[model samples]
Target: MKAFQELAETLSTTLAAHGLVLRGGFNFSAGEESPTGPSNAPAKSVLLVGQTGSAPWPHFLRWWERQPRDLKDPLDSWSREVIGAVAYEFGARAVSPSDRPFLPFQQWAMRAEGLKPSPLGILMHPEYGLWHAYRGALLFDREISIQAPENPIHLCDACIGKPCLNSCPVGAYSADGFAYETCLSHVRGPKGAPCRDAGCIARNACPYGTEYRYAAEVQAFHMKAFAGL
Candidate 1:
């Protein structure tokens, strides 16, 4: 147990240097109920791994540019490579957000961080808003003690105007649900340049965690990715 704790501490510190954090974790020893776990593996715990804000973007982009572009799903490939290496070093299995039989990352994140979804369906982080992301996770074959995060105040609850809902030109997000086709069509249209170049206007309108917002370049990259541009 002490060894595992030490390993966790070391991993947390190491990952932080790369702008990744051990966001949260859970123990799923035999007989424990969980909606998401390795179906074919003897996993006893899962560590939620992710990044906050744009701190990792520059580093990731730098590495990404150097990788061969011939491969499909470069971003997912990179995440799998890096996180997989970490898992190898630590004697665990690495799983990415893009993996087949997709792991319920949102559920894992909600359980680990006590989070609630924003209107955009991205988890509303008290300090990161829509600026954070889960990259991958590590599944261990032995239980590791990790405390569940105390629930933070849900920012969307007290928002007066809900600017996020009002900011989009196409009404892409709303109480009814995201207008997927509306958003896609608009983003692919002539007037999409601003949205493409500056990221989602609605997401930018979010007042919480303004300080942690991604840089314009990072935003543009994500926007392009979303638009398949």
Candidate 2:
């Protein structure tokens, strides 16, 4: 336990310097299959890494300014570079949401943090609301003492009106599920200027984490990327 705490502290400090946070972690349960790690060994534990609200905005902006404008998926690439170094130094293996085989990040997050998906599918933290994300994970060969969050709070349950469900101009999200082509087409045309200039209207309507909402520039950057502009 001491060793795990020490390792977590050291890694958390390093990640903080880069605008990332150790969202949380957990040890694999007995009989559970674990993620593959160094040398193809099954990892015994994992620490989820990510950001809250605009935590990574400024840092990512600085890093983005240094890379070529045509750089593909700069955010994912940057996460790989930074977390990969952290993994090397700590003798752990790095995995990302974008990795091939598509590790079950959403499941891992739900288990570690006791968070459930909001109507928009982003994990809704009682504190962060809809403004948090899981960027990467660090896999370890040894078990780490960590606790799963308790008494999980699903804010959407108490959120009457559910403004998020009604804010979109194209009615892209509904009980039937998301209309992907509808959303994409809308954002790609001139009719989408407002959505293109800002972030998702539905996302913004989620009032739980108003204080943690992304800055205009940060939201604009993501909007452009989502619209493939």
Candidate whose TM-score is highest: 2
Q: What Cα-based lDDT does every candidate model obtain?
A: 0.84, 0.88
Number of backbone collisions per candidate = 0, 0
lDDT of 1 by residue, 1-229 (tens): 5765787798998787778888888887568654343444567888888898887776677888887876566667767777888888787788888777777899889988999999889899988888889999988876786766798999999999999999999999989999988998898899988899899999999999898898898888777888888
What's the residue-level lDDT of 166 in candidate 1?
99
State how far residue 169 of model 1 sits from its true place (Å): 0.3
Write the residue-wise lDDT of candidate 2 on 144-174 in tens digits.
8786579576999999998998999999988
Clashes of 2: 0
Q: Quick one: best lDDT, which candidate?
A: 2
Tell me each candidate's TM-score.
0.92, 0.96
Query: Where does model 2 exceed 4 Å of error?
Result: none
TM-score of 1: 0.92
Per-prediction RMSD in angstroms? 2.3, 1.3
